[model samples]
Structure formats: structure tokens, C-alpha cells
Target chain A: MFLLPWFLGLVFITLGPVLVSLYLSFTRYNILKPPRWIGLDNYVELFIWDPQFWAAVRVTFFFVGWSVPLVLVMSLGIAVLLNRGLSFLPVYRSIFYIPSLIGGSVAIGLLWREVFGSSGIVNQFLQGFGIATRSWVATPETAPWTLVSLNVWTFGAAMVIFLAALRQIPTSLYEAASIDGASAWTRFRRITLPLLTPVIFFNLILQVIHSFQAFTQSFIVSNGTGGPAESTLLYTLYLYQRAFVQLDMGYASAMAWVLLIVIAVFTGLLFWSARFWVYYGDG
Target chain B: MGLAVLVSAMMAGTMVPPAAAQDLSGEIRFSWWGSTVRNAKAESIISMFEKANPGVKVSREPGEWGSYWDKLTVQSASGNQPCAITMQSRWLAQYADPSILQPLDDKVASGELDVTGIDSAVLDSGRGSDGNLYFIPHGVFYFTLFMNKTAIEDAGMELPPDDWTWDDYAQYARDLSDKLPEGSYAVGNQGGAMDTFTDWVQSHGETLFTPEGEVGFTKQTVVDYFDFWEALRKDGVTETADQMAEIPDNIIDDTLLANGKILIDARPANQVDGHQKVLDAAMPGQELVIHSYPVGPSGTGEDIGSNGLAIGATCDENGTKLTEAWINFFTENPDAAATYSSDNGVVSVDRFRTAQLENPDTTPGQYQAVNMLSTVGPRAKSAYFPSGGYSALSGALTSAYETVAFEQSSSADAADKLIAQVKRLVRD
Candidate 1:
């Protein structure tokens, strides 16, 4: 009975739209006109005919593969550093978590563009010291990395989760290890690492999912056209280009489902891998 | 007592005409994308509409340009579209289908919408591909170069004429850049812009799309267009790709032209005042002058289209009649038209255009721009952009431009990729 409101929302707000989009995926819909049923044509065209579809997949996968690991490792490292019994711990924690709190925000995206732009802060800072720099957004090779760096900067959220788990790890484990003559690295490797696996798994899956669907940074940096020869056309950006700019809602719907399946499969694989890596205190 | 009061009301109804008091009473939702100035003008006009017809309420929904379509698309599909939607000529064709927008001809015939003041050619442009009048253009715009007079003088160069060739443009810009400050440029690299290419192609007696809806220009035609920009880059006449990309998507504040770092840019004629205003604020001594696109060897590179109003299909029966009334009131009445005063664009009606030109408050630049547009309005043809995937084609143009300029790829390669991409989108 207590779950009634959520169940109602699932039916009306979530499930209803999901089903409509699934239905739209098989049709010829332009949003401005009536949607006509075409039965598998959109999916067929997307897979077999569209080069952009393949390009989007390649770009999105490349982004996800690197960004997920970077966030995982970096956040864990910072969390461990903060957990070393430092003064003003709460202040430091809040300061570090600020980026995550405002991660994927539009203002941050605009800020990122300014920092990476030619004649921007990055170049200004570099040149102030007599070093030359290139415009990160203009160079095709470096354009996508600007967006990656944005994601990496938001490691604070995961670090906070890691900090909480680190605090729960029963310091007796570390005390016993030290008394037994174990090295600091060895204590971390054997005790802290295993103890933090559950949080790592949590953060990793969430980060991967978040990274896959990233839109704001890429959109703002690329100036909404995803040009500079479409070098920074992330999957969601491309999906948006199709749906709104091209008015091809049917194809966009199909693209959305494909993205969903890709994310689900990746998440499933992570869970499968977790059996070997993730360890619990009780177990 | 109630029966006596009812008898007295019936007598009052006999004294007052029923048609004038309650005619076309309902609410209308009018949506448009505009600047803050435009939103204020639109709101004032809406209140004018509401005042003229006492019982009718006209709602104003104003948004900035970027997210207007993103919202419009969902609204259209959900059958929740506003009664009156502001549309562009290139986009008019997309919304022209009978199922989406109401054709305005019947209203014209019924005297509900008066089109007598608008020129015949301008009126005819409102017709969709199906020859139905689904849009009513209020005012027109043409793409032209906004040149900085002071900057050109600083560079010790003469201003280019209206009849200069492409070669002349490149040489002059190169010369201007030579004398300018080290970081400043003659212009941003705009070789990939669709409007620029359209002007070039038309001057050559070719086009982006043919009358029969096929690719109008040969591969060699587009390739030569690309090579033109490549030649400029090689000559150091244009800004580097990095410097150009530094200002993304032409935000006014970031524009090199606004910052006095660039001497010229191709802008829609109506925006001359805004550009000049920016220049006035940012670079106090700089003054801007608008001129026609360079005349090519074969033809003049000019096209024109106007912002239009379309009636969405979702309006209920009463809303439809009221929408017609609102449009007629907005376009036909000179006082109502003056409320907009070319912020929406140059006014469409002959009476209002003349009114705006004569108003002492109208700036000299705006007056000249509007005067020039009115003289050229009759001959301007809208560029032919095919519906369904035309925006993608435009994207391809910019993509090809970037590939040639930044990637150092031959224009031929970019052209080939563009042709193939266009063909693919058009194929379906």
C-alpha cells in the first residue's frame, strides 16, 4: 500500500512513455506530422544503412571505456587520501564533492568550453608562463578529451561514497595488520581494497551509466551542431540531432532503444564480473 | 423580479448588435522565438489584440532561438501545439503539410485575413510546395556582409563595392589582414556556411536543389566552392580554424567581428542594427556598413525569405477562428504592426514599412536597412531546402568546411563526402 504512489508513477509516467517510444521505434514518425507504422524499417535502416549509427557507437564506447576507469581509480585515490585523519575533514570533503554535486550541469559545461577554448583560461595560464598552447576545442583529436576531462573532474561524488565505506572498515583490521608487520601498501591491498569493493562496484556502475548518457558538456562544447567535423558527436548528442534537428523521431527512438540495450548489457557484464572482485565483510 | 430583469436584458440585446459584442471570443496561444526586445513587443501586441476584442485572451509564449524547436516538436506530436507558431521560410515547407498547419487562403477569401498590402510576390511565397497558403510572411531578410568601416580604414584599405568579384574579396581581405594588428583578422572562415555557398552557386546559375527536387550543383561546382576558402587560408586572408572555432555557434559576445578582431562577416540584413550596437558597445570607434554579397562572374549571389506565422492543427474550432482574427489583427492593422516595429523583422505591410521608415525614433542604420530590403523584397526567392533531412545537409556543409580548413584535407575529399552524405539522406 505504501508503494502505491511509486507504482502509479511507474505506470503513468515511466512505463507509459517507454512503451510509446518502443512503438515509435518501428514507425515513420517525424513529430511534426502523423506517425505511420512501417514495421522494423527504422531499426533495419539504422543498423544496415546509417554510417552515423556506427560512428556514434564507436565514439560512445571509447568515451565510456576510459571515463569509467578514470573516475573509479581517481575517486578511490582521493577518498583514501582524505581518510588519513586530516583536520578540517568535513570542509575538505564538501570542497571535493562540489564538482560532483554540480557535475553534468549546463553552467559547468559552458565553463568547460571557456577553459578549453583557444585564448581561454587554459591558454592564458599557459602563455602567462611563456608556454604555448593549442585550442583544445578546435583540434579534432583533442576536442573529445575536453569532454572526458569534464567527467573526470566530477569524481567527488564517488569519493564521498568511498569515504563512507572506508570509515566503516573496522580500523582493527589495519591495527592487526600493522602489528603483524604488514607494510602500509600491503594493508591497503589486503584490507582496504577488498573492504571497498562493494562501494567501488556501486560507483563504477553508476559512473558508467552516467558517462554513457552524458549530453550537456558535449553539447555546449560542440556548440549544438556537433561539428568541427562531428568529432565530438557523443551518442546522446547524435540522438538529439536526429530527433529534433532532423525531425526523425522514429529513427531517434530506435537509436534510444539501442543505447538502452547497450547500457543494460554493459551493466550486466559488470555484475557478472563482480562475483570475482567484490567482497563482503560477512562473507 | 428575475423575469423583469431578463425582459430588460432582452431589450438591451435588441439595442446592442450581437455580432460586434461577442464575435470571435476565445483564447489563443501564440508562440515565437525572439530576443527580449521581441518578447516585449510581442506581449504589447498581444494586449492590443486582447483589448480590441474584449472577450478574447491571447497568450504569449516566447523563447530564445535554440530550444524553440525542441519544445515545438513534442508539442506538435502530442497535439498540444499553440494556435499561432512563428516559422521560417526554410522551415515553412516542413510544417506546410495540411495535417500540420491550416492553409490561409480560405481566410483571405472570406476577408478574415487581408493580404492586399503585402506584395504579390511576397504573398505567393507563402504557398507551400502543394500550392496551398499555409504561412503568412510578415517581413523579409537577406544574407549580406556587415563590414567594419573603421577597421578597413585602419588597415588602409578601400571599402569593397557591391559589384566586387570573389577574387577581389580574397585579395582585399588579404591586403587588409597584412596591415592589421597581428592577432586581428579580415574575417572569420565562412566557406562552409550554407548561405554563403548558396549565394555562390546561384551566381553561377546553379543551385543547392533543382526545381525537380534533385541535387542542383555538380560535384565540381561544390568542390570549386571549397577550394575558394582553401585558397584564402593559404593566402592568410582568413582567420585560422582555431581562432574561428574559439567563438562557437556565433554567439554575439564571442564573435570576432563584435570584438573588432575581424573586419567583416555575412549577416542577415535585419540584424545590422544589433551588430552595429554590439560594435558600438565593444569597440567604440568602429562603425558598420551592410552591403550585398559579392557578385559572381555569372550571377548575383542573393536570396530572400521572411519570418512567417503558421496556424497549428491542434487548435479547437473556436481557437481556429480566433487564431485567424489574431493574425489578421496583427498583420493588417498599421497600429498593431508598429508595436513590433521590425524587431519581429521589417514590417510586412506597405503602410507599416513606410511608417517605420518615417518614424523619427528609427535609427539611420535600421531605416537604410529596411528601405533597401523593401526595394529588393519583390525579386527575392527563398532558397530551396528540402524537407525531412535538410538540416543534416546544412550540417554536412559546415562539416565539409571544417574538414577542408582544419584537417588540411583537400576540398575535393570533403566535397565527395558531403555529396555522398547528402545523397544518402535524400535517398530515403
Candidate 2:
């Protein structure tokens, strides 16, 4: 009896729409009328007929393939630098962490546009060094890189997590290594990296998932049309365009399900590979 | 006997009373797309309406242009759209069905909605493909070329002649480009602008879409249109593709044209006043001028559209009456028209158009826009956008142009791709 509200909320708010969307994936639903079932048609069209779908896939894969690794490396590097005993560590950590909190927001997306724009601060700084530059966010070849840089800029969240895990590492191990006259680089290579593998694996899976779902940055940067020859057409942004702008809810639903399955497969692979590299202190 | 007397008086148009007598009591939801200035104007006009009809209450739901349609679509899907919806003629076919929007023809035939003084051609622009008038057009809009007059004068070049053709337009830009200040272009790149392309197509004696809702213009026309802009870009008469990509066309504050980074660009005729204001603030002493699109082989193939109001299907009888009354008040009421100041487009009614033109208080930019519309309205052909046609064409045009601009595809290849994408998207 006490769980009625929670149960009702779960059923109505969460599961209901999910199931409805599953049904809608196979139907012709434009939201204004009752959905008409047309089995496998949306999927068939998405795979064979739609050119934008392929473009979306290419853009999303590029974003995920680059951004996830860059973000992980940046966060780990900064975390290592800050993990050493430093003054005002909390302040530095806070400053570094703020970007992650607001990075996915519309305001940040807009700020990123202005900052990478032709006459923006980056260009102004480059111009001071006598380097001419075009608008980084506008060029089809370089536009996706701006978004990659934005994702890397928000490495603060992972950095904080890494910092926490670094603190949890036993000081005795380092002391023993010092007594054995192990070099700093050797200590880091043999001890620190292996000990941090679990956390690295965690951050990797989380970031991979996060990067796959990215939308706002691409949407805001491209002005919602994913222009400049659809260079920044993220998968989720295309889904949004199909569902909202084109009013093709059924196709969007199919696209959503495809994305879900892709994420699932990728996650499954990550887990299967984790046994080989991820350390849990069991050995 | 009293009821009979009231009915007879109402039918005879003799016993006219305020909203209370006409039974116009109840609140109706009204939604529109605009900026803060337009929102304030709409609010004041709505308040004036509420005052004149004391028993009526209007709930305002203003939204920005980009997200307004998305929100409305969601609301419509959930069956909660506002009683009164501000619709554009280009988007009318998408929601014209009786399930989404109420056909206003019945209201007009019943004398409940007054479209008096509005041009019949403009009224027809609001009709869906089914011949049902889904909306009442309050403003008629067309495209025009906005020039930085100060920049042209500074470059020691005269504005293109009134009878300038596409070639002459390009030549003028090229001539001006050589003399303009550093870092400024002769024009903002408009190879992707759908309306400009429409003008180009129409001038070649072709329509953008057939009456049967198929792609009307040939791929060769598309190729020629692209080549026109490509030639200018190659000659440094326009901004770089990347710079053009950076600036959004809708936002006046950041537009290259308004910021004095470009000598000329195509913009909606009604936006002259807004653009002038931005230019005034952004680059003081820079004067803005409005000119019709350059003539083509056929003539000025200008296409006109409209911003108008429609009633949602879910509106109750009382809500419908209130919506009809609001529409009538907006259209027939001179004060409302004057307050609106033709923010969206030129006033559709003849009297209001004339009044605004004659009013000394009207800014010169606005006056020029209205006068330009008057001159072009007779010759301007209204394009009938099929369901999903506008959005599809807009996206495809931008994508196709970008591919050409970035050297990824030739103009001919891009045009072929554009036609294919449009065919798929529009009919999907």
C-alpha cells in the first residue's frame, strides 16, 4: 500500500510511454492521428531509403569515436596533476568541475558557438599571433571538431571521479615502491595505472554512453537544421528533427529503438572486453 | 417574445450591443510567434480587445519563431492546442485538416468572422489544398533585397538600378566589392535562401511547386540558380561559406548585413524596419534601404506569403465564438492593426495599409516596406506550399548549397541531390 504512488508513477510515467514508443516504432504515427501499423516499414525506409540517416550515423560515430577518448585522456591527465598534494585543491577541483555541470545546456552550446566563431575569442587570440583563421564552427571539415573540443572541455566530471579514486589508493604501496628505489615513472606505470583500471573502465563506459546520446550541442551549433552539409548531424538531433520538425513520429521511434540497440551492443562489447583489462583487486 | 426580438434584431444588424449582449463571455487561448516587441504589441492589442469586450478574457501564449511550430505540433498531438493559433500560409497545408484546424469558411459565411477590406487573392493564400480557408491572413509578406546604403556610398558605387537583372546585380556587387572597406563583403551569401531561389525559379517562368503538389522547376533551373551565387562567391562578392554558415538568417542582431559586414542580402520585406533598427544600433550612420528582388528573364517573380490566425479543432462552441470574435477584432479593428504596426508583414486590409502609409509617425523604413508591397502585391504570385514541402525544401536547399560551397559536389550534382531529397521528404 505504501508503494502505490511509486508503482503508479513507474507504470504510468516511465514504462507506459516506453512500451507505447515500442509499438509506435512499427506504425505510421504523426501524433495528430491514431497510429496505423505498418510492420517493418519505418526500419526498412531508415536503412535503405533515407540518406540523412546514413549521414547522421557517420557524424555520430565520428563524434563518439573521437570525443570519448579525448575526454577520458583530458580528464585523467588533469586529475593526475591535481591528485598530487596541492594547495586549494577543493577550489581547483570546483573550478574544473563546473563545465561538466553546464556543458550539455543550451547556454553553453551558444557560448561554444560564439567562442569558436570567426571573430570570436579563439580567432582573436590567434590573430594576435599573426595566424589567420576562419570560423571553426562553420567549416564542414572543422565544425565537428569544435563539438569535440566542447566535449573535451567538460572533462571535469570524470576528472573529479578520477581524483576521488586516486585518493582512495593506498599510500603504503607508493611508500614500499619508494623504498625499493622504483622510479616515479615506473611506479606510475606498474602501480597507478593497474590500480586505476577499474575507474578508467567505468569512465569509459559512462562517457561512451553519454557521447552517443549527445544532441543539444550539435542542435544549437547547427541551428537545428544540421547544416553546412549536415556535418554536425548527431543521431539524436536527427531523431528530433524527424519527430518534431517533420512530424514523422513513427520513423523517429524506429530510429530511437535502433539507437538503443546500438548502445546496448556497444555496451555489451565493453563489458565482455572488461574482463581482460579492468581490475577489481581480486587477483 | 423577447428572445425572438433579440434574434430578429441580431439578424437585421440593428440591435448591436457589446460582447455581453452578443454572449462573448469566456477565455480563449491565443498563441503567436514573435520577439519581445511583437509580444508587447500583441499583449496591448489583446488588452484593448478585452477592454472593448469587457466579458471576454484572452490568455496569451507567445513563443519564439523557431520553437513555436514544434510546441504547437506537440500541443496539437495531445489535443491541447490553443483556441486561436497564429499560422503562416506556408505551413497551412500541414495543419489544414479538420482534425487539427477548423475551417474558417463556415464562420465567414455565417457572418461571424469579418474579412472585409482584405484582398481576395491574399485571402486565398490562407486556403488549404482542400479549398477550405484554414486561416485569415492579417499580413501579406514578400521578399526584398536589403542594402547598406552607407556602405555603397562609401565605396563610391551607386545602388543597382531599379530594373537591375541578376547579371547586373552580380556586376554591381563585384564592382562594390573592390572598393568596400577591409573584411566586408559585397553581399551575405544567399545561395541557400529558399525564398530567393523561389524568386529565381519564378523569374525563369517556372513555379517552385505545381498545383498538383509536385516539384515544378527543372534541375537545370536549380543549377543556374546555384551558379549565379557561386560566381559571386568565387569573385569575392560574398562572404565565405564558413562565415555565411555562422550567422543565422532570422536573428537581426548578428546578421552580417545588419552588422555592416555585407553590402546587400535578401530579407523579408516586412523586416526592413527591424533590420534598420539593428543597423542603427550596431553601426551608427549606416543607412539601410529596401529594394525588390532583381528582375529575371521573365520579370520580378516575387512570391508573397502571409501570417495569419486559425482556430484549433478542439475549441468548444464558446471558444470558437471567442476566437472568431478575436480574429474579427484583429482584422477589422483599425486600432489593433495600427498597434501591430505590421510587425509580421504588411497589413492585409486596404484601409489599414493606406493608413499606415499615410501616417507620418510610421518610420520611413516601414513606409517603404508597405509601399514596396503595394507595388509588388498585384504582380506577386503566392506560392502554394504543400504539406511538408516548405520544411523539406528549406533543409534540402541549405544542404545542397553547402555541398557545392564546400567543394564536395558540383552544382549540377548538388541540384540533382536536392531534387531527389525534396521529392522524398515532401512525399514521405
Candidate 3:
């Protein structure tokens, strides 16, 4: 009974837009006019000739490749540290989680620009340390990495989930491993590693999807143009440009569907790989 | 008996007055994008209008420029478009559908909307692709390059003449940068800007697009333009490629020009007021002077454009009537015009434009804008921007220019890339 609203919302909100976007992918639509059925023209145009589309794909791929693993490892490591019954545990959790609370907003994106900007705080500190500093966000080659750092910094949510998973692992198992003459690394590898696979799998899939859809950080950093030579043109930002700025809804829809398929394939591959490594508590 | 007949006829005819057209009573939904200042002026005008003409209400829907079009496009398609839709030249065609904005020709003919104080060319410029007046511009924005007079004097360099060539502009910048404080630039970068490119190519006797919807300029044009900017960068005249990328579109804010870090800037004449204010705050008495775009190498001309109000398709008779009244009041009234202070570009009404400049309260930017408009006469020509083509072309222009700006591609290669990209878009 409780799931009824969610199911309704899925159909009306999530699934509805998805279906419409899929259909629109095959049409020629500009927002001002009625959509004309063009039958895959949009997709053909995007794949065959749209240089920006290809650029966006590369940018998105680059972001995901770096941000996901960085976020996962950092979150897991922080979670492990917090799991150690340290004094003032709650305070530390709140302090660390603050960055995540403001994650991926335009405000944070603007903040990231300042933090990584030319003559910004980072440069001040670097110059103080007798190191030469260059504008990180303004430079095309380093702009995306600034965004990646921002994404990695906001790892508190994943950290919290990992912490919860850590607490659930049987304390008896760790005690038993200790009695069995196992070292810290050995016990962690034998018992904790296998037990945490499911959570790791969950976090990986979630982070990958989130990282793929990243837009705001890049959009804000690049001043909505994906500038300094299209170096920071995240896929969603490009789609948004096509959809709203250029008024090419059909092309944007095609881009959207392509992204959806790519994410779906990755998630499917993750699930397929899951049986080989993810250990269930029941087993 | 004759006198009585005449008196009866006169009484029946309402000869003294046309029986004050029923006080235009209705709610008009006015939408626009602006800064806080524009919004405040518009709202105050709205209230004054409502009070003077009882029973009328104006539902204001103001926003920032960045998201204005997104909201307008959605509202237009969704049938929720406000009765009064604000229109900018670049985005005008995107929303100027017969099904979106009612052609104002009929309104103008019937005297429901007045255009007497506006020049016919300005009125005609608002015409849709169908050559019908679907939009009515209240103001005009002439794109002109500005010279920070103080910066030039500080650099001990004289200002370039209005008819200075592109080469002269660059040489002047180099001279300034050589003497100015370190990190201070001689000119602002215009590598990826379509507007600046338009000015360049126009001077070269080719526009980005011809009247018949063909790409007017050649690949060589793009190469030469890229090379011109590259020369500036190489000579340390303009902002570094990295610093160039950090500009926040609006010229009035925390920019090198405001801070007196750059002497020459390409900005709309309308932005002068805000630019002057910021300049005063940053480095008082350093005024911005408007200069004509460097006569293109080909010696062609510059582009003229404006922002205006368009009546939406969904507006009912009463809503449109109220909108017409409100638009007229805002345009023709000296008080309203003075309050706006050429903020929405130079006031389109002749009387208002003259009145604004003549007012002592007017900012230096407004004064410079009016001066530039009068000075750049006949040399300014507004181009036709087809909806999707303009935005896509702008994006492509950015990509091509970025290649050269970032040192990732040669000027020739970047030009070829730009030409091919524009061709693809125009063909589509």
C-alpha cells in the first residue's frame, strides 16, 4: 500500500519522461512547434557529425573514470576511520558530512570555481609554500580535475553508508580472527573484505551513475559556456545547451537516450559481475 | 430650430471627448529578465499605472537573463506564456512564432498600440520572418567598443580614432600593456565571442550570414580573425587565454575594465551606465568612453540590435489592451524613461532618448551610449538572426576559437574547423 504513491510517481514522473524522451529521440522537435516525426534523424546527426556530442562523451567518460574510484576509496577509508569507536564520533560525522550536504549545487559549483580559481585561496597557500601556482579552473587541461576534486571532497554520504555497513559486520568474527593468530590485514582481508563486497558493489554502481550525470560543477566552473576551449563540456551541459539554448529538443533527447543506454549497460555489467565477487550475508 | 438641431447632433456625437475609452480594466501578465534595478523601476511603473488607471493589475514575472529564455520557451509551448513576453534580438526568433506572439501590425494599425514617437526602422526591426510586427522594441542596444579613458592616459597613450583599423587597435593595446602595471591588459579578449567576430567580419565585407540565409563569410575570414586575436595574445595586448575564459558575461561587474586592468573593451553601449558606476566605485573619475568597432580590415560596418516586448498568443483582448497601455506608458512617459535611465538600452522613443541624455541625473554610461549612437549613425546595421542558427553558430564559433586560443590548433586549422562547423549548422 505504501509503495502505491511511489509506483504512481514512477509512471507519471520518471517513466513518463523517459518514454517521452525515447520517442522524441526519433523526432525533429523544437519547443516552439509541434514535434515532427523524423525517424532517427536526430540520432544519425548526433553520431555521424555532431563534434560537440563526441566531445561531451569524452568529457563525461573522463569525469567518471577519475571521480568514481576516488570518491569510493576516499569514502570507504573515511568510513573505516570513523568506524573505530573514536571519542566524539557524532561530532566528526557531522563535520565530515557538511560538504556532502551542499553537494553538486550551483552554489558549491561557484564555490569550487573560487577555491580553484586563479588568485584564489589555493594559489595563496601554494605561493606561501614557495610553489608557483597557476589558475586551475581557468585552464582547460586542469578545469575538469578541479570538478573531480570537488566531487571527491563531497564523499560524506557514501562514507556514512559504509560506516553503517561496517557497524553491521559481526564483532564476533573479528574477535575469532584475532584468537586464530590472524594479523589485522589478514582478518580484514578474510572476513571484512568479503562481508563488505555487497556494499562496495552498491556504492560503485551508485557513484558511477551519479558521476556520469554530473553537470552543475562543470557548468558553473565554465561560466555556462564549457569554455577555455570546450575542455569542460560535461554531457548533460551539452544536452541542456541543445535542449534549451539551441532549441534542438530532438537532438538533446537523442543525447539523453544515448546516455541512458550507456548508464544502463554499465549498471547491467556491474550486476552481472556481482555474482562473481559480491558475497551475501546469508551465504 | 437650426441651432437646436446642431446642439442635439453635437451632444449625441460626444464631440468634446471620445468618451474616455473605458479605463482599460484587466490583469496583464508582464514577463522580463533584468537586474534588481530594472525590476524595481518596472514594478514602480506597474503600481503607478494601476493607481492612475484603476481596476488594472500587472502580474510581473521577472528573472535573470540566463534562465529567461528557458522559462519563455517552456511557457510558450505549454500555453502558459505570459501576456507580455520580453524579447531580446538574439532570442527573438526562437520565440517569435505566429502561435507564440501575435503580430503587432494589427494593433499598430488600429492605434491600440502606439509607435508615433519611435522611428519606423526601429519598428520594422521588430518584424518577424513573415515581415509582420510581432514585437515592439522599447529600447535599442548598439554594440560599441569602449576605451577606459583613464587607463589610456595612465599608460600615457592616446585613444585611437573611431575609424582606426584592426591593426591600429592591436598596436595601441600593445603600447598600453607595455607601460601599464603588470597583469594589466591593454584590451579584453574576444576569442570565442560571435558578436566580436560579427564586427570583425562585417568590417571585412562579409557577415556571419547573408540576408538569404547563407553563410556569408569564407573560411579565410575565420582564419584571419583568429590570427588577428592570436597576434594580440602573442603581443601581450589582451588578457591571457586563461584569464579570458573567466569573464562573467556582464561587463558591469567585477571585470578588468571596471578595475582599470584593461583599457579597451567590446561591450554594448547600453551597458555603459552600469560599467560607469562600477568604474567609479573601483577607480573613481576613470570614465568609459564608447568608440566605434575598429573599422574591419575590409572596412565594412557594425551590428545593431535591441530588446523589446512582444504580445503573447495566449493573451486575451483585455490583457493585450492593458499590455499595450503599459508598454506605451513605459516608453513615452518622461518620468518612466528617466527612471529606466537607458538601462534597457537607449530608449527607443526619440523624445525619451533626448530627455534621458539631457537629464543631469543620467549616468556617464548612458551619456556615452547616446553619444555613440548619434556618432555611429549609418555605419550601424542590424543583421537578421535565424533562431537555431544563431545559437548553434555561436557554439561552433566558441569551439573553433578555443582551438586557437588554447594553442591546440593552428589559426588556419581552427578557421577551417569553424567554416565546416558553420556550414553544417547552416545546412541543417
Question: lDDT per model, in order?
Answer: 0.80, 0.90, 0.81
Candidate 2 structure quality by residue, lDDT tens digits, A59-130: 999999999999998998999899889999999999999999999999999999999999889999999999
List model 2 lDDT by residue over B1-428, tens digit each: 99998899777674353343576789999999988999999999999989878889999999988789888888998899999999999988778889999988887888888888888889999999889999999998899899888879988988777888988888888888999777799987889999899899998899988877899999999999899999999888899888778888988888888888887999988777778888888889999999878899999889999999999999999899889889988887888999998988899999998999889999988898999887789889898788778988988999999999988999999999999888877753
**Reference-based TM-score of each model:** 0.91, 0.95, 0.93
Displacement of the residue A30 alpha carbon in candidate 3, Å: 1.0
Ranking by lDDT: 2, 3, 1
lDDT of 1 by residue, A117-172 (tens): 88689989999999978889877778888888889999999999999999999988
Candidate 3: segments with Cα more than 4 A from true spot: A1-7, A179-181, A281-283, B1-22, B297-300, B420-428
* DockQ-better candidate, 1 vs 3: 3
Candidates ranked by DockQ, best first? 2, 3, 1
RMSD of each: 5.8, 3.4, 3.4
Docking class of 3: medium
lDDT of 1 at B91: 68
Q: Backbone clash tally for model 1?
A: 0
Give the alpha carbon lDDT tens digit for every residue of B8-127 in model 3: 988877542221245667787889899898899898887777776777888989999878888888898899999887887766767667888898887789877777678776777788
> What lDDT score goes with residue A94 in model 2?
99
Q: Which has the higher lDDT value, candidate number 2 or candidate number 3?
A: 2
- After superposing candidate 1 on the true structure, give the runs of residues whose Cα lies further than 4 Å from its correct spot: A1-4, A281-283, B1-24, B211-214, B314-321, B423-428
